[model samples]
Target: MITLDLIGIGSGNPDHVTAQAAKAMDRADLILVPLKGEDKADLAGLRYRIIESCVTNPATHVQGFDLPVRDPATPDYLARVSDWHDAIALAWEAAIRPHLRPEVPLKVALLVWGDPSLYDSSLRIAERLAKRLPLTLRVTPGITAIQALCAAHAIPLNGLGAPVTITTGRALRETGWPAGSDTVVILLDAGGAFGTLDPTGISIWWGAYVGMEEEILISGPLAEVASQILETRSSARAAHGWIMDIYLMRREPALP
Candidate 1:
């Protein structure tokens, strides 16, 4: 049987790696890291650094594999994503099978960013693998980008007795603010979706590279800092060649 541990390493910060995740890494016979190409090489490097810091077991082996890119020509969003995930699962199996020996039980670990239960698809991809292999899956939860964003801004996640909506940038842009939710946390925004809404009564707490050394934060009335955020985000993406950011917005008159 193959024991697959999906360990969440937190949002780009080594300090955020949980004790349980570290222990799993130390126990694993092999760890797989995905390289998302040159534009995001730092992401793979961070995973390697985390493994180096956490795994003291000399018997543990680390391997890297190239991740598959989603085909944009597929047109249907869900279909494209499904194809991409299947490809990823295939890549995982190809990278893992050569290293496994039938003589002994094997444990393989994949370090995931943030909690697997959140927007991450690692668990889904792992599920696909389980259908094809004798696999037992385990998860070790880590801090999410939402938690990091709130902690960095020193703010409560929601107003008293109020509902908070957690969603993607595309949803906010296409559907506008969700009904009955005064507080919204936006993630995976490839574009500044907040720009589509009127900034009049909204206050934004935004951060890029949230817990990393290159972290950038800008918070204020959306009307006041919206342009600044766009400029900053653009400049940072240009400098680093990639970026991951999240933000929280709350309308005024929040419960005291």
Candidate 2:
């Protein structure tokens, strides 16, 4: 049996790691890190740095495994993601099985970018692995990009008891703005989803690489800064080969 601890390390900053998360890392028998290709090698490097800072137990083994690229040829979005998750699960088993002992229960940990309960999919991948291995899963909460974005911009998440909507870039591009929630937080934007919106009477707070040394923040009327964000995002991605960003949008008449 494997006691799988999926610890949320938070957006690229070692200081964002909670005490609870550090303790979990220190106690792990083995830690698995995913290598996401050279384009996003910085993400993997950050995980290694965090592990170095927290994993005091010399017995804790660290392992890196290549992440399988999703099949872009798969037409249906849902089908593509499902197939990708399946491949990742297989990759995980191949990485961990070598160190497993039939007689002993293993404590394996993976450092997640943000809270797994949020937009992240590590939890879902773990579920697939559980089907093949005897596993007990535990999640350690850490600051999410939403929290980090708001913190970076020094703004409240919601407007006076109003609800908040959290969605991915694909959904925001396809569905338009959701009703009811005045504040919307967007993640996993491959590009500018905001370009699809009307940008009327809307304000945006945007952050890229929040909590990291390369962090950038831009906030203003969506109408005013949309072009700026698109330009900046392109330049940053070109410079680093990859970029991760999150942004919040709300109706005008700014909340107090």
Candidate 3:
């Protein structure tokens, strides 16, 4: 039976790893780090940096595997994602089976970016493993991108006594800005999703690579900074070869 430790490593920052996550890493026999592509090699490196900084014991080992690419040719997005997760689970099994010991339960840790609960597929992949094998799963939560995004800008998450709606870029684009929302936090945005919304009276606070040393923060009226954001985001992505960003929008409410 595989003992899986799904450790949230936080937003690409070694310092953001919690004490519990550190201890979990120390106990793990193998830490499986996924490489998305050449563009995201830095992300894998960041995971390695976290292990270097946190795990002290010599017993733990870190390993890397190329992540299975999602098939973009599939017309159905949901089905495509399901297939991708299945492929990832297969890769996980392959990585684990070779290193397994019959006497000792395999302590396998996967360092996930951001919290595994929010906008992450690690849980779904783990569920697939559960169906096929008798395994024990443990989750250690870490700081999410939302928290890092707000912290980077030094802003409160929501208005006083108001609720905040968190949604993805696709949902935001499809719905065309949520109604009755004082504050809307958007995640996993590819680019230019904010341009789909009405920018006249709204304010935006945007952050890329939040909590990392190379963090970029931009904010102001949506009309004023939207183009600047697009340009800056593009330039940064070009320089770093990849980017992860999140932003919040607040619309003006009619006076009582």
Candidate 4:
């Protein structure tokens, strides 16, 4: 039987890793890190640094494998994502099976970005692996970019008992702002999806690289800072080769 632990390492900051996640990493016989090509090499490097900093167990081995790319031509978003996840599961199996030995206990781990429960798909991929072999799965939670964003700004997630809607940039762009939500938190934005919404009566808090030293934050009325954010995001991505960001938009209540 193989024990698989999907540990959340939080954002790019090593300090965001939880004690439980660190312990799990130390306990694993093998830690698998996925390389997502040159554009995202820093992501894999961050995982390596976390392992180097936290894993004290000399017995644990670290391995890197190339992640599979999703098929862009599939047209259907859900189908494309599902197919990509299936490919990733196959890749995990191919990488993991070689390290397993007969008649010996094995514990393998994958360091995931943010908490697995959030928008991450590590848990789903692990489920696919579990179906193919005798595998026990465990997950250790870590801070999400949302938490880091809020922390960096020192702001409460929700305002005065109002409901907060968490969604993706695609949803925001496609559907516009959700009804009855005083605040909306967006993730996985390819670019400036906020431009789709009218900036009137809305306040936006935006951050790129929320927890790391290269973090940038901008906030105010959406109308004033929308263009500034687009410019900043473009420059930051150019400087860092990549950027991970999240933003929250709050719509003020109508005056009676």
lDDT digits (tens) for residues 1-256 of candidate 2: 7899999999887899999999999999999999999999989998999999998999999999999999999999999999999999999899889988988989999999889999888999999999999899999999998899999999999998789999989999899998777799999999899999999899999999999999999999999999999999999999999999999999864467
Mind giving the per-residue lDDT tens digits that candidate 4 earns over 1-256? 7999999888779999999999999999999999999988988888999999999999999999999999999999999999999999999999999987898889999998889999999989988988887899999998999999999888999999889999999999899998888899999999899999988999999999988889999999999999999999999999888999999999988677
For model 3, residues 24-91, the per-residue Cα lDDT tens digits are 99999999999888888888888888898888989888889989999999989899999999999999
**Per-model C-alpha RMSD:** 1.6, 1.9, 1.1, 1.0
Off by over 4 Å in 4: none
- lDDT (10s digit) by residue, model 1, range 150-196: 99999999999989999999899889988888999999899699999
Instruction: Give the CA lDDT, 0 to 100, for residue 9 in model 3.
Output: 84
- Candidates 1 and 4 compared: the better one by lDDT is 1
Candidate 1: minimum summed lDDT over ten consecutive residues — where? 247-256
Cα deviation at 94, candidate 2, in Å, is 0.8
Candidate 1 pairs with clashing backbones: none
